[model samples]
Target: MAISKKNKSKVSVDGKEYLWWVFDEYDQTEFDGIQIKAVSSDQTHFIKYGLQQSLNNSKLVLALKNYTKLVHLSLPPKFENNEGVITKTGINRMIKWCKKDVHHIEYALDGSRNDLTEAEKQLLLKELQKIIR
Candidate 1:
């Protein structure tokens, strides 16, 4: 939380809007993404959410759940990388960090190193956003 980058943005879900802050811990490395702090439009209170992984849509879901008093966390679809981001030897360690999500959105499973396209990423985000509402 000692980090000083004050990134903020507005997000709309279920016809309602919210404000969020992105900050990383002082000890956290650049590879680790920042945590999200968000609050509703009314500003009654705030929520600090950290999911311990990368992926924009998933992180957004974490924020929406913490910001509201309702049960939104269970709605966001969980995801996992079929083939590990690391080498075979380090695969298990990375998978452990993925937090037991499903691999519905397959990546690198077909023995190809192709990166995700912008359109594909947007489509996935759209699918995830659908559950947020």
Candidate 2:
């Protein structure tokens, strides 16, 4: 499905502009969470993130906290904008994650079958800290 242009917002990351939009899959039973989609202004790079619902908490507090860590690494929580539009930091993080071939984080708090390994997570975290600053 094509995302309407009116629904997309603009953000620039690393001097490159990107168009981003949030796809709320309310009827989706598998993940039961929103999907953030973005593409570079030049249409060269595309990235998507599935922010799945946490199995441990229905309120999404724990899920979001963990997701923030997984998605943004050590970056502050302010980088995430939950109110429909995505923050610039969030876009940058998504691009970084995409380049690493990392996508969504499962809701398993036990770290079972996650997308990123412990070492990989640490590496990405360090890289994010260095670049995002």
Candidate 3:
């Protein structure tokens, strides 16, 4: 079996819904939250394994620090009186974060493309295609 079984079906704990996820290799993934999966099965597996490994060797403090950094990076510039704009520093930081977070193979496969202004997106798409191809 693929091991997509539920141990405690539809149970609520402390007003939060939790699901018990099992892997065919006898691994268990339990959570009270939802996460978006990658479109490709290989990507999904790679991401899940990476997360599980990180959860094992990493401290909560480090996780929290990473979360805080992500939050800071995600915050709108308007919060700092920049009016919801991303400065060059912000873009550089974002690119740095991506370089650190993403695997080289995946990065090569899918370049830095996102829903930005048409001109920017086009430029990113062009560069991405060049790298990917």
Candidate 4:
């Protein structure tokens, strides 16, 4: 199901307007995770990132950082804590990553998905090794 327009937040990225929203997914009574979904003003491009944990501002920042690190992309700017809710800047960062050629493939407009690819896993392993060194 598509996110309702009333629930979505709007942001302008690089002179283009986009709409984004966070939705909770559930496994029956149990809570799954929250997915951040965004689409261009024209609706031609869509981005979705799922976090397999409960939502909060700190966790959202960490998830964005970890995802970018695994992809060998620069970490997104720190987000403001707006009462523990996701902020527009955080959504903007996701949109930026979505526009990149390398990262965009992982968040396909077609909706087929995986949390991480084997190559990304290996790269993250190497990064971890470097930090441990």
The candidate maximizing TM-score is 4
Models sorted by TM-score, best on top? 4, 2, 1, 3
Ranking the candidates on lDDT from highest down gives: 2, 4, 1, 3
Regions more than 4 Å wrong, model 3: 1-82, 102-133
TM-score of candidate 3 against the unseen true structure: 0.18
Which stretches in model 4 have alpha-carbon errors above 4 Å?
Answer: 1-4, 27-32, 52-84, 104-133
Which model is ahead, 2 or 4, in terms of TM-score?
4
Per-residue alpha-carbon lDDT of candidate 4 for residues 15-118, written as tens digits (9 for 90 to 100): 77778887787673112566666666665445455544333321221122113342222233333244546688877766554344332122211123336665
Superposed on all Cα atoms, model 1 deviates from the true structure by an RMSD in Å of 15.9
lDDT (Cα atoms) of all candidates against the true structure: 0.37, 0.48, 0.24, 0.48
Give the C-alpha lDDT of model 3: 0.24
- In model 2, the runs with Cα more than 4 Å from the true position are 1-4, 26-32, 53-86, 100-133
lDDT per residue for candidate 3 within 1-133, as digits (tens), equals: 1323334223222232322222333333221222111111111111111112222232110011112111111211121114533333433332233223322121111123323454443344344323212
User: Tens digit of lDDT per residue, candidate 1, span 29-130?
Assistant: 212444545555655434334434545444222222323221112222222234412222232222222223332332211113236554554444344334
What lDDT, from 0 to 1, does candidate 4 have?
Answer: 0.48
**For each predicted model, how many residue pairs clash, with residues at least 3 apart or on different chains?**
0, 0, 1, 0
Candidate 2 structure lDDT? 0.48
Candidates in order: C-alpha RMSD to true structure: 15.9, 9.0, 16.5, 10.2
